[model samples]
Target: MSSQFTVEKTQHPKTKPDQQNLGFGKHFTDHMFLMNYTAGEGWHDARIVPYAPLSLDPAAMVFHYGQAVFEGLKAYKTEGGRVLLFRPDQNLERLNISNERLSIPQIDEALVLEGIKELVRTDADWIPTAEGTSLYIRPFIIATDAALGVHPSPQYLLIVILSPVGAYYPEGLKPVKINVESEYVRAVRGGTGVAKTAGNYAASLRAQEEAEKQGYAQVLWLDGVEKKYIEEVGSMNVFFKINGEVVTPALNGSILSGVTRRSIIQILQDKEIPVVERRISIEELYEASVNGTLEEAFGTGTAAVISPIGELNWEDKQITINKGEIGQVSQELYDTLTGIQNGKVKDTFGWTFEV
Candidate 1:
């Protein structure tokens, strides 16, 4: 594990973009944290250097076999000029989970957390102050072994980059349409679905692109095995409120254990809301929609926090959720989560980490 890290400031800093239109992951901060892992030695040579394109060997295993793992979190700037992070330890812990699944070496979570704090402090100016805006943190590891093969790589490189981003969607908190994807499967039960790996996302691009072309925001994925049970959305975890109960898909080793999803469940429990994590089938969901029991639906993730689902097109049958508007539960969850994030509300859950 690397404890001490070197900081190298950039001499030619790029101009910061307009906070109003920063968009999501479009602009990066001036500096990025990088570390290396060797076969004999553990993680070492941690440094924060100028943000630039990486120069890797063309035969790097990551280019060939896609042995990469990544995690996403955020840093918020409060109105009182203070910085806060939301459930960063959970994110770092999940980083190791992905690493274990991807055959990449596990990272020291505490060390990485400290590195993240230092990196955030180094680029403090890049933290956006606009409404519903914050600094996005991306930590990733790639197999850098020059010799490519099907086996694990001997060397790896870990990088942590910061981005000044607004809301993940143009509609912001507005509910968006979701397409129920029955054609392509995201991951099987015994596959790399739970891991935050690149291939999993690459497998989703086609479905997402088609959904977007059809005027939808994203695709709600089904379980790969049955293709009838709801798994998750393309980018976020899906939740449904039906018959006065909150329901989300139970983690079946094929769905990502989302930090936001966990937080939302905890929040619901704290408020004594009936929350259930189980296998929800599309047929059951559609039946509830027809029976007028489906009350609300939303997707949770680090980038979007809470994205209400206004409409769902499954097998060419569309249903408008909560009259195509964000429901009471969705609104409350968004407000509570964002308030804690931006220091607007009291954080009783101890989720916010002040920086």
Candidate 2:
């Protein structure tokens, strides 16, 4: 792995958008980081080039076999004029986990991190300093072998693009309604459930569409084997505060180990709050709601950070959590996590990496 990167500035720079109206992932930065991998030659040709469309053969393996993986993180501009990245190492490590699962070549984590830092530094002006805006970083890899085969491609392209995105939800921290999906299963154990591959999200589209039709923000998935145990939410990990304890479904090889989820758990434990990870069943959750013990429910991930789940619609039996408002725990966690990311609060865990 080489530490050198060729730089190419865009000849025609586009006008920057208003930070106030920057929606999620709608606008891209001027440049992107790119690299290539060959089966025998390893990863090479690392460079920072102008953002542009890719030209791939019609028979590209990624188009046919779906041998692709991606990871998302964000870079924040602090109030004091410092730029920070939140736990990028964890995301890259998870990317390699996905690569191993998909039979793709392992990436040089340190080298990739360097590339990301350089790219972010180059595009530092694009980092929005608005109330809830930051530069979203998307790193992805796709099989590029131009063959109609159902196997891993011998060649791969790795790219990292930046987007100045606003709050993932239009309502900000306001609670959202989620549908408990029963008809569709997102992933199964021993499958590609845990891996952050393209297929998992593709498999979730139908259920998500139906949930949207029902006026829900996202769908809560259940275990595929029995369809009784709680799995995760559409794009985040689900958590519940029942009775006096905080509980999230255990990572049973079918749920993504979200970076925000881990940070929340750590923050809870640091505060001496009771937090547990185990196999939580939907029936148990519903029973808790019946007994009036189900207090707060939220989803944690990179995009939304902490999405307060206000209502759970299970087979038309809607249960409003925390009176359909944000709970104390959810609010505190969101504030603390976002504070650390933006350098407003002390990062006791040393999670943020300064660029």
Supply candidate 1's per-residue lDDT for 16: 98
lDDT of 1 by residue, 130-204 (tens): 889999999999999999569999899999999999867655678998999989999988999999999999999
Per-residue alpha-carbon lDDT of candidate 2 for residues 1-355, written as tens digits (9 for 90 to 100): 2348988988988899998889989999999999999989999999999999999999999988999999999999999999999999999999999999999999999999999999999899999998878899999999999999687789999999999999776567999999999999999999999899999999999999999997999999999999999999988999999998999999999999999999999999999999999999988999999999999999998888999999999996888899999999999999999999999999999899999
| Model 2 local distance difference test score | 0.94
- Report the number of clashing residue pairs per model: 0, 0
Against the hidden reference, what TM-scores do the models get? 0.98, 0.98
Report the Cα lDDT for candidate 1. Answer: 0.93
lDDT of every model, 2 decimals? 0.93, 0.94
lDDT of 2 at 234: 89
How far in Å is the alpha carbon of 87 misplaced in model 1?
Answer: 0.9
